[model samples]
Target chain A: MEVKKERSNNICTLYVDGVLDYSTMEPFVEKVRSIEEGIEKVIVDFTDLEFIDSTGIGAIINLVHEANTKQFEVELCGIIDEIKDLFETIGVFQIMEALQEESD
Target chain B: MCSREFINEQPREINKTLEREIKLARNIQMKLLNGKQPYLENGEVLGVSIPARVIGGDYYDFYVLPDGKLRIVIGDVMGKGIPAAMLMILTRGAFRSAAESTHGPGETLTAMNNAMYNDLRTLGSFVTVFCADWDPKNNTLTYANAGHNIPLTVTSEEDIAEFPKTKGVMIGGLPDQEYSEESLELDDRGFVLFYTDGIVEAQNKDGEMYRMERLCDVLLKSYQSNVKDIKESIVQSLNIFTEGVPQRDDITMVLLKSR
Candidate 1:
């Protein structure tokens, strides 16, 4: 997978392309982990994402946890229907919401 | 000179010992997972798990309750290999303890989440589980989900769909999760298949997934067969599709059929 970052003001958008899976998750995890401190919000764009395995999902969950700890907003956008369904089934959105609520 | 040779062999000896220990761990896991299949009055239940590595994080179990209800659970830990395998044992222990006291599938999941939540959070991992209670007397299956894929119910070649939806966060995803339950009445000759993501996600040499549609087609064709045969059909189909490509994740499933 490939991640391209674009920054505007305090918000940073990450465009993910190709499959985010077990074999290709390291770079994505590194990118999410290395988000700059000054960013107030992070948006992950999944329009070009083709597939994600459980490991990939774990990486995203870790990112959410990091966001919660760092007190930044994280938004997932452009997720295709299939990935969205998978995320819903696995309660990714619920975790995000739950952690966000706890922080609040 | 002799001391130098002994030192040179020390690393090899340690490697061999580690390999032996891993194999022993694999054996223990297999023994625990492949324990006796619960006998039903008018139905059959079977579970199978194939680890991608020597040991895996996928788990499934069958517990025959005092009321004659069979409690079944299938789960996938967040990662693979040894760490996940260790967590799988933790999950199995929690499920076994909870199944004994819980009133239903939903309660069992709540208890499991309560039991394992802190450890999973500390480890930065999670588990997706689906739990169900099969009542032979009523031919009804009541189930709850915790971030796991819903099982499919097959009545006939023309009728196959996912189990009714029940929502809950994955174990360790949040604290104090209360899983909700859903029920389905199975007709005679109907069956339910609970599986992990590995089956549909199985990839071929061409990097193409096996997909749910193909799985549904296989289930449709094998709906009439016994549970063991149906399991074989699925394994055969996967083998045919994957050819010699190595498995990437742990595959697990439990089949409950009403006769």
Candidate 2:
């Protein structure tokens, strides 16, 4: 997957494009780690993401786990139907939703 | 000039030995992967794993618990080729060791995760697995998953398929991970298809993926066939879909049909 980062004030948003699989997870993890410290909100935009596998889901879970440990907010937006179904099946959104509720 | 010839001959001898050992390793792996199938009076279990290379990381095995329950596991180690193959052997060892002492699929997975977590983390890799215990007499299949794709169940009469929903993180991702088991009763003439991602993520020449929907379609069309025939149908469909493009990952499947 190709990740483009945009920063404004203290918030950082990642725009991910292309297929995210086992081969692409290292670069994706690096992109997530590259965000500067003290960023309040971390947004992952999946508008251009076409395909993702279990390994890709694992990377997202790692990102969510990082957000939890580091005390930051993570928002996932623009998920396509298939990805949404996959996230739901794997209970990714449930964990994210629980985190959001905990933060609130 | 004589010394140079001797040096070249020594290198060639080493190369020949290395190639011979690799071939031997491949044979060992194939034998392990295609081990004896368990006999279930009311059911039939068949598994096929095709490595993209001579030997690959995808693995599946069947073990018969003392109580006569069949324990089956299918896993995909991260990446492919030699490094992944070595880890695949490690994973198989862990599973066999754990299955001997564990009570259920969940416990077996927990044991495997505990055993392999350190090694996998040190190697910067992970494995996804789907474990199931089939009780043929009871006609129930209880399963637990480690971030693997949910297996699809298809009936001979229905034109659609459904996936069993079970959840857990990938093995080796976190230490002390707990996997929960779910049970489903099988229809008399139905089958459950457990597969690795390579089957669905297979890409065509135009970069279009074969995908899950198409796989479901193939399964639905072949639901009336025997388990072996069903597997052949899926393989044929995949070939047609990819249009002879080189395989990128290992394709593996385990099917259990209620007889």
User: Which docking category, incorrect, acceptable, medium or high, applies to candidate 1?
Assistant: medium
Winner by lDDT:
1
Write out the backbone clash pairs for model 1: none
What shift in Å separates residue B54 of candidate 2 from its native position after superposition? 3.7
Q: What's the DockQ for every one of the candidates?
A: 0.78, 0.23
Q: Candidate 1's error at B30, in angstroms?
A: 0.6
| Candidate of highest DockQ | 1
Interface RMSD per candidate (angstroms)? 0.9, 3.7
Residue B114 lDDT in model 2?
Answer: 96
Q: Which ten residues in a row have the lowest lDDT in candidate 1 chain B?
A: B1-10
lDDT of 1 by residue, B38-61 (tens): 888799999999999999999999
